[model samples]
Target chain A: MGGSEHDDGRNGKTPSAVVGDVDDFWAQALVDVPRETYVLRLYVVGNSPRSRGAIRNVRKLCDEHLAGRFDLEVHDLNQEPWLARDAQIVAAPTLVRERPLPVQRIIGSLSDIERVLVGLGVSPNPAVDP
Target chain B: MDTYESKTPVGETITKSTNVLQKVPTGIKGFDEITVGGLPRGRTTLVCGSAGAGKTLFALEFLVRGATEHGEPGVFIAFEETAVELTQSVASLGFDLDGLVASKKLAIDYVHVERSEILETGDYDLNGLFVRLEYAIASVGAKRVVIDSLETLFSALGNEGILRSEFRRLFRWLKDRGVTAIITGERGDGTLTRHGIEEYVSDCVILLEQRVHERFATRYLRVVKYRGTMHGTNEYPFLIHAGGISVVPVTSLGLTHIASDERMSTGVPRLDAMLGGKGIFRGSSVLISGTPGTGKSSLAAHAVQSACRRGERCLYFAFEESQGQFVRNMRSIGVDLKPWLDQGRLQFHASRPTLFGLEMHLANIHRLVEAFDPSVVVIDPVTNFEMVATNAEVRAMLMRLVDFLKSRGITAVFTSLTAGSGALEETDVGISSLMDTWLLVQFLEGSGERNRGLYVLKSRGMSHSNQVREFHLGSHGIDLLDVYVGPAGVLTGSARQTQEAKERADAIARQQEMDRKQRDLARKRAQIEAQILALRAEFEAEEQEVMAILEQDKRRELVLGRDREQMARLRQADPNKQQNGGGAG
Candidate 1:
């Protein structure tokens, strides 16, 4: 896929997990058993520095752990504009998790790790990590 | 289906078969559930209450509910509150009065009545009110009319007699015209409406009150009298929230609570065990009655927090304490309702009883119950509510409410303040008969070291252990200890030896007792006085008749004298029966 994070997210325990954007599903990321699994397709326009950072950071974490726990497919919005249409991406960098229920999308640069983790398919940190 | 039903002639049904059909639904949440349908098709219902007891809201909501929910056009005629104020206040309640008014589905008329503003009897016959009402109603082709309140114009008129006649005329006119009207009135002491609006509007009269006792302000509603329909006579607790006025008429006492066979903790194992099977059934009414400072509220709060911890909705209606103080106080007991409130599962309806009357208290409770739909409800010290209702009647109300709630599957928790030192238990204006579980949080004063105790006095239809468990109010919350009951009941007083022995026990205790006694005495006195007044009225009528009789006797005597003079003239003419006694007879 286009340099996205994990592939075998269906089994969970992915390090570079992409959580959904909905606030209520935050705790779902930390659970041992996976309830909701999504086939996330991320859209980035022309591989900008922000896009490159997201791809590198996300892939690095997944390889160190999950490897095949989740599936992340990235598409360049400018190159395959038609793919963006399928995911209903209005902006350059968008995350569309298309499975489970209620197809969700998040339009942001995905800099905040907690946001990224919560937005993709990952659980929240159990403790505050004092 | 009652008194007037049999007596009054079956009036011609106004809804003709050919009339276009549409139902007007009053989306008062639970109220609609209670009414089965809504306010009678086209009959008027007088929603009377004291100032600021949410009379206007009740009427406006009826209008808004009719307009939006069921597509029934509505007209709101304001007498006291400005349109802007009504909109602003109701908007906080999540109701957009302006939008409804603008949609042309609703019409609002702000009627400003000034006594000085040239109101003459010859020209004015409530016609101004009628004109404005008609205009608004016509603009929307309204099926509902709410004059909130109708009495403002009457209040402005110094000539009270004229106001009474005008009220009769206005309501009659409305009835004839066929518009379901809700006329708001200011509640006086006795009558449903001030200025004796009760005599005329006997069909349906709903009384609302806002009482402030111990600095807590709450509202209640009661159907003082409903003519046609059979409704729960008990005053329903209501709440004025961000939505609108909500009335809770939980009048079904459970003779049929399914013993869940479920055991829940009282937060303290000992106390829980004492409450039989280690806990009370879900949706049961747990009453904690005790003298002041017996950790009643804390115990109730403990239950609430426990319920919340289990992720169930919990609501606490505190009559004595503020939300913060309640939270902080319960913090000692380790019970927190704040989290659930944040999650929209817990709600605290705190206000003073004196802020309204018994009806307002009932209405406030009703409103809160509807809005919260709490799995568990706690009224910390319903003694304030006792102040508003008659002991026997209050019990009846409670019984009905208990039954009502049990049917809906909700647990209720109440803390009753037992006044007086020798009080075996503070009898709540007769609400004991209605309680499902009675927990006595007594204060024992033996051995010079006063201590508090918690005991399960009684639990109806359920087995409970009869043991006194010790408890104390500390920084954390109410702590329950298994200190063997030394015979003396729960005690509360000084733990530390003081120097001067001053502070002669604050006015809180004495004042409440004094108030209770004073209220009793005053009620008795008023009853006696009313009886005496009635007798006096009868005697006055008789005396007036006697005086008239004496006057009649005097007039009779005068007539007799004239008769005697005519007889004398007849005798004078008897000379040959001179010209045939023409003057004799």
Candidate 2:
């Protein structure tokens, strides 16, 4: 996967909280790690822009890096309306890696390959040349 | 902190036969490893970390790994994430939280901390948390419990002091009900935990931090404090991965070195021949010093693999890679980590060196050694430890680790990073000072071919190769030469004398090998003696059983005699004794 999304960009994504030291799990995830294998499911409302974009971005990542290694299942809350209440998919485009172990759920774009991978059991890779 | 001191078993029948008091194992992999066996059956370990340090992941791992791996169900209490969100996040980590929920082995209770609502004027026990947690743990017969980001309560409550006291009571309550809990708190700089959770949880505190150095980010996990037991203080590097968080605490190697005479090979015949023709002494600590990219870790890994092939349990603590990554990379250099790991003969304890305090590393090493019972241990680079400890402290810690290894009769091999003209002897930060045999690796200046070299600076009670050998990593592994050192001083760190240095290394390795053999022989002798003692004990046990039986029989005979004599006297005293006796006859 291109490092674009994983790169802690110079935008509003820069944590609004002025923290000299990061304390959130996402910050720790930026130092992405190696892959273990993951099964993710994205909960979306419909073919809405936000849900569609999240799906597209995440699928690109899986195809690029995870490829055959993962099983990503998308659940459209709009289609199965009851799932929103049953599984309580409060946030749309919420992706979940449900297999291997230590299951993880990302509320937003499974977009950041690094965050998604780190959450999925793939550790951040060290530069080979180093 | 277990504080098991007060609750020692008092009165019980010694001869009883029962195994009903079995306890469940903690779900975290290395957590249990460092904890010797596992956490005490019914207690609490407060994992307080800064936000997003994987506190929730940790809690989930405890519950999921416990329920899945160790067969102990768990309850995960998330105050921020909704249960669905929590499930989704964990699903990305490869945890089937929903499936776990389905099977009833794991439960997720998202306690929405609505800051906008409510007044607690009365004595409101966090009975809600207790009820939910209790229900979750019991539904699947959970043996573990975790409250992710418990500090949220503090944030919502707006009373620090009350929260602190309440926490203490809550933990005590959990313990009484026999639940091994992991309560997570947010970290505030200079504070052990958010909302002053440390006041109540001085027992076991793990601090995880995300550090960005040179635009590169790393997560560190450190056991800041464990009240009763020793834990590594180093900030163990961790990765947020599909499996949640993988913590790598490099060899917390202590000064525990066991003196052994058994000859062990470095997979280099010449080198072995140089060490007195036997091999590196079994359980002997060897320090390999080198600059970056000098094949230090590769060479060490080769030696470790060699020992592992011989049925010795080898632990390779990589400060850089996860076990999976380490193996994958090593495979390119012809090192097969799978078989060893599969057989449980070789265990990898790979963590970033910066993740822990120097002492924490020592404790982690001790803990792993205890759990794995490895015969051979290897640390990739001891020099990195300088970043964590003072020089004196490093020396003392190494000495202690060496001593501990010695007591356990474990052979240790460590690589130390260096940047100098010669061997690591001149570099105080290197572990050469504490090593029995120092193998020097460096880049040969003139040749410019990334030359791999080796030499033995010293060997205690043994003669080893003095030559620096030219070797390279290949498909089979690193192969050493039987060559001599160059005329240029070994300190010069030049490649012009590569051929000569190779010879010297060979000779040194041979000498070290021979010396190692002698030590190994002695070790064998000692082991034999121990075995004899063990056998003797076994014999004594049988003897005691026989004796107990014989003594019991003798007592029984004496009682029979007393009864018989009394009966005779009674017979004689009876007036109709003679008539009765004659009739009976």
Candidate 3:
């Protein structure tokens, strides 16, 4: 896993670099190994403590396990409140895994990494499994 | 966030206003009147009901009516259905939800919670819902909010403790925002709501019930609790129709209507004569009770025609017959109602008695009376309601109807069909006490024939004739004739005619005998006068002979005196003696 590029993606500051690196990594990895990209969206209310905690925890979990194989988007419901109704977000700090065939939703701050990985259909022991 | 932290606590706010409770008018028909005003202002009212009990519609109507009628914008947060589905469902009720939303007067947020796709990881809060609600309310500046079936959240969410505390916070937040809100819940076993939502939103609670009695369903609304105001506690029957939910708060109607002294004719002149000289009083309820085929409807039709002829509008509700059939039947009695119908002065609303429950019928009558504003109304055969409702329910419904009509000063005529076995004075519906005037028509079974006899049983505030007139439904109209009361009691039908004919013949015979006696007395008087003339003639002749005899005696006496004078002169010696003797003779 490329740790620097994953850090840039988690910071959400260098989106172009993360995309370029992910493309390059995909081109090389496709020849050597087969991997599926994970699509995830995190719904939060403003910049509250819980919202920040959930965002940081989800980014750290994604970078440590599925570095170049995941795409995460943070949605602020305060800015776009109608999306909460659209996504059926009853609780704040809700994480939805939209891809991987069947959609799954988990509500809370994502403080437990094991539960987050299992909820997102990501293998905790990704190196040994793949 | 600091925004949620700075809100005032719910308990402190409620305690501050414990002396006076302000109400927000829902603008639902008859609902506000029952609640005395409406739900507590800036508070949440729990509406709980069973399945298919019109809970969503009730809440939606509250929001719609508030938005449209009270100029108050509303936010409808639906948990069970989407906005499009709700809008389409309420279209039949004449609610333009789409138009309202387009005009920015209403905002609908469909909060769909599916339990199967959700997995609870750890602690969570419902701040997302709060954000959505706040956004919707602010967008429309809504003063009224409806959360249709808040119990849906209990099914979707796993943790009860978090959901309960979050709901409490949400209710407090809504109150602090100064918006009146309604939260609907599915009824629970032995509880007001399945999830005990009532335990939080306790300012006001309304329970809606759809009871099936005798295979007919009736919706009732009861205000289970109102915090600080006096509200009607009875289960008021409500109807969901094209207009919307209308709660009939019948007991709230006060007897403060003014009585009118004006009189209107009953179309039948003789019937009018029977009911005071000028027919029934204006704004009075007249009951025409009779057995089947005894012309109860005909008598009511007469009043309707009479009202229409006076250029006053009339509404006739025929419970048993259709409009065409009723018109045709009335035409046979010479009471043509087609012209009145054509002219739009008389409106006919025909339906079966079993078409709806008693309250529905009453609500419909109220609606029609309001729309038509007719001066006269007729409910033909109110007894037909017995087939649909109990006698007490029918009576209560009729009492409300009568009170409504009386308050509006509309002359109402109700026909009641009495069973042949029951007393003629008693009606099956038992609504006669509410009537101002009662006309009883009975079948006079006599002389091997059945005759229709009509009598004024009671007419309040008027001097009416108590005579039971034998009325015939002729080609022209109803004709009231003097019933013959001979030695054989009250005679009617052919027996009356036969008695009348016999009296006429006896009168002729007695008149002829009187004429013969008069002629005989005249003949005897003439004979007595002739005999008197004969006696006067005989007396006159006899008197003349007597007078002639007396004259002869006088002349003889003169002759005798002259002879005596002559003889005395011849004797010459005693002239003086002879003169003396002649003088003596």
Candidate 4:
């Protein structure tokens, strides 16, 4: 169901071959009805542009892909700076996936939707073209 | 930035506001002396070294010493090891990191960077690291900061461009905070650090090296670059022991020690008499070098015992023998050191030279000297140090040690064992030049025995003896006997004894010959006097007989004159005439 909106205007410049692969993978994912709940936390530094962009991009990815099956939380490191050390955060605007067994982290603004999908394990497309 | 600046109190700002570059003392022994002061204040220093080069320990000592000695709080941001692991690792060095943390004097933040779990998606800044560092610093009110290896970020984040920029900002930020910071990095090929951290932190850079020479490891530290101040460029040997890192700044010890005019005895009165009739100068370095079994240790022991007898504390460093062995051996030479030991006036520190590197031995000696505060220090068999270090290195070490002891006004006696058949004047350790008094002892093999011969090779500022004396280690202690100088040259041991005995016998024979001559002269004078007496008696008898004949003749003449009585008057006249005739005859 989310396969149609996978190629948003921001990702429109991606090579069509990779887009085709992502589209096919998402299409197969719709038939499988993936029910695994996704857990994510986004760490940011105040109201910086990268922070705002990461927050927006990560929320959009979770809603468009997992929808109500995912839970997301946002933390501003400026207000709770100690959380950076506690969460082992080095760079600003980081996303940590804490659910579905082995945890994973993605650093930087989550602008590349395909890479975010592949990183979150939502899309089965192994070839992540960024 | 404004908030951080405001958080720094006005008092701190005023204290740190100075035109001249300020330094914070590191409190490491001999390190601050060479650096003149410590690291540049409120600036980042790059410490780069290979693995096991004691980089971590050096940084840790800076923090611990800052907190404990200087009352300055610090933050340790460990990137390689966790805080707990670091605590355990440095515990061996007697650094209580956890206790320091609990006392609010230190703060440890372990920044775990795992490259596998994290994926790079887009643009990001290392503000998170900054935030954590700032939090730790603010929480402890720290004035010193240690980021043990900032290079780990390159491997973890894999973004050189961003990481490099971030490092530049972090260093500047640390400076703005007015906190002295140390950033450690792994050594790289042809560079000070693997990640070129030196390029960012240009205030100061220190390189630590651990080299294995002849199977012995010695750590060296050098200041490669210092921005605003003069620094020692030589590679100083450093030692990591229970007391942490101690850098032996050998050349930095300028020859500025005061030359003392006072003298202390060398325990042997005869030896002291040989050295200007008083002894070596107080605070002077005395080198007693001799061949093996030449009573070098015994001479050193004599000095120690004499020092102890004067109620002055003495420290003995034995490299070739244990405490009991040395004390017992000295006892055989009548130098009883046990009483001094029991009285706490003497201390013995014995260890094999191979147990530690030359620098470590020097550092240990330094520590013991400081702790004991002895008036005299004896290092028996200083030549053993050659096994662990080169001749030049041993010389340098001894030079520094001599300088240190002189500065403290402590008399130092160093006994060196000369190798077989080498020049007695030239010690293999090459430290003779550093000594103020040099006593050379050698084995004189003659008359089927090896006897010890000692002479003052050099005594600075004093007229020392030039004659080599027979050094005897008897049960009554060292007695220096004048070597027998005869037609056979300098003879010692049984040869000297035989020569002395022969001279004594010759002297007796000469006395006997003089006595025999006197007796013969007395007998001849008695015989001559008897002959004179007999001749005088014979003359008297002959005179009497002649007088009797003359009387008989005179009587006959008188009878004839009486017959012619009338001629008596004429006889009286004739007597007067005869008297005049006799007078003429």
Candidates in order have lDDT scores of: 0.66, 0.66, 0.87, 0.86
How many pairs of residues collide in model 1? 73
DockQ of 3: 0.56
Which TM-score values does chain B get in all models?
0.56, 0.53, 0.93, 0.88
Of candidate 2 chain B, the 10-residue stretch with the lowest lDDT total is B1-10
Q: Is candidate 2 or candidate 3 better by TM-score?
A: 3
**Candidate 3 runs further than 4 Å off:** A1-34, A46-49, A126-130, B15-19, B427-429, B516-530, B555-585
User: Order the candidates by lDDT, highest first — what do you get?
Assistant: 3, 4, 2, 1
Instruction: Summarize candidate 1's per-residue lDDT along B1-585 as a digit string, tens digits.
Output: 111012322344444422532223578755654554556666678888877888888888888888888788888877677789888877887888888888898887776555433222111123334444555676789889887776665656555665666677677667666688888888877767776777777567778777664455556667676655655665556777656766655643337766555656666656776776668877677888888887788788778777877878877788899988887767655666677778877788788866766545665666567677888888777777766655654565566567766666788887788884765564653676667788887766655776787777788766787666667777666666655422343333442212113223545667789999999999999999999999999999999999999999999999997887677665785655535544445
> What is the per-residue lDDT of model 2 for residues B1-585, given as tens digits with 9 covering 90 to 100?
211112323223112314332234555545554544445556677777777677788778778888778777787777788889988878888889889899898877776644433222212224334444555566678678888778877756554565565576677666666677888887777886756777766457777777654334556777776655555666566666544555543454343334566778886676777788877888788888877877777777778788888888988888866888878878888888799899988888878877756655776786789888988888877777767655665676677677677668888888888766554558844456667877777665544445666666777767776677666667877776533333544332244445557768999999999999999999999999999999999999999999999999999999997886667667775547644553242
Model 2 chain A worst lDDT window (10 residues)? A1-10
**Per-residue alpha-carbon lDDT of candidate 4 for residues B117-212, written as tens digits (9 for 90 to 100):** 888898988888888998999899999999998999999998899998888778777877879999999999998888788899778999999999
Candidate 2 lDDT, A23-102, residue by residue in tens:
66455445332233455666665465666677786777666666555666677654554444444342345555555434
Which parts of model 2 have CA positions greater than 4 angstroms off? A1-130, B1-24, B33-37, B117-131, B157-169, B201-204, B210-260, B264-273, B282-424, B440-455, B465-585
Q: Higher lDDT: candidate 2 or 4?
A: 4
Q: What is the C-alpha local distance difference test score of candidate 3? A: 0.87
Estimate the overall C-alpha local distance difference test score of candidate 4.
0.86
Which parts of model 4 have CA positions greater than 4 angstroms off?
A: A1-34, A124-130, B1-17, B427-429, B523-585
Calculate the i-RMS of every candidate, to one decimal place. 32.7, 18.0, 1.5, 2.4
lDDT of 1 at B118: 26
CAPRI grade, predicted model 4: acceptable
Higher DockQ: candidate 1 or 3?
3
lDDT of 3 at B391: 84
